[model samples]
Target: MAVQSWTDMLKASKKTALIHDGKRKIHYLFKDGKEMAEEYDLETDELIVRKWRQKSTLGGQGQWQVEVGEQLASPVASSGSDVIKENCSNPVLTRKDTKTSFQWRIRNLPYPKDVFGVLVEASERCIVIKTSNKKYYKKFSIPDLDRSQLPLDCSAVSFTHANNTLIVSYKKPKEILTLEQELLQELKKLKGTAEGDIDCKTQ
Candidate 1:
């Protein structure tokens, strides 16, 4: 992406959920070094990106009001035969879960004219993204782990649009068991069996 200091606050909470205990979350967009927070509600599929305008009054502190902006949609979707062709950069992978079994999918990416690169960052809960160039940017939320059938975790996330196909893989866990731990288990098993079989000839 052609953004200057538009780093994503992946693990950080950019905007508070405005729904008041509703199933809404925060997505972020940074333009020209300024951060804009977008609130998305999963229940209603409604999105609102807001910009705060400061209004100063005489002999008083300035008041900040929420100014609603354009509705930006997530760039991920299913690929079809009629999809248009475009060039998208390779997906940046981040591992969410440490399990052995993997879950993944191929999606059709929507590339806006200003969208230069698709930045993907995955956590244990969801995958956050931002598609942007120099002048503009858009934020997306692709939940990696969801109980509902509508959205689920993708161990291997891939996207296809015309000639470009982006695939994202999960980082494997370092190791489940150490060599020393394995050897100790084997020794314990052997000792347990050796004690029980020593008097077998007496019978």
Candidate 2:
């Protein structure tokens, strides 16, 4: 899928059938090295959650992990109507969005900065974090970029360790920023159903 728009992006899936549990529209995509599942609110068609997993170096499939749909609200906070907020109260991880980049903070790492490494796996189009001692490992995607159909750039990824926390940041691409503005403008014209009008919908 070229992902020309938000609808195009949502429609690019390999699953044969679309499924919904009355509250959300669910879709699945399975590719060479990764698989993803997405959920969207039925009334608003807004992404509710996404989970994905990738092939492991050890030759077995890795466990499915969240790719930022539920925990992180829409990243397109271009309109005054949308202001992305972080749950700093989360004990494990918290995300902070800045003007130029997206950042994720993982707490209680207790390791030196050198022990942690953050990298972008282009094949999976996601970020992977690993420790030298093999104690901590995580794989997660940037939903903002994914929704915008943007490519992952290894150079944009960087990390630092301080105060027993590991903070990773990815520089935002210019294309994504522009697309967000356009999407926000387009979304303003559409009226969504109210909370009481929810219904089941297909992907």
* Model 1 clashing residue pairs (backbone): 103-154, 103-155, 104-155, 104-156, 144-153
Which digits, one per residue and each the tens of the lDDT, describe model 1 over residues 1-203? 74221112222323323333442333232232234444434354333333443325454434333333332334646677666545444332222221332223223443542344433444434443445544323344432122111233354443323323233333322232232234223322322222224344631
Residues forming the 10-long window of minimal summed lDDT in candidate 2: 10-19
The lowest-lDDT stretch of 10 consecutive residues in candidate 1 is 4-13
Cα displacement (angstroms), candidate 2, residue 188, comes to: 8.5
Candidate 2 residue-wise lDDT, 1-203, digit = tens? 54266545434535422434644433355435567765544465444555777779997978777654335444564767566555554436666555467788888788789998899999998899999999899888887777667799999998988998898999889986666455434443335344456456774
Candidate 2 positional error at 76, Å: 32
Model 2 misplaced regions, further than 4 Å: 1-4, 7-91, 183-203
What RMSD, rounded to one decimal, does every model reach?
A: 22.4, 12.7
lDDT scores of the candidates, listed in order: 0.34, 0.67
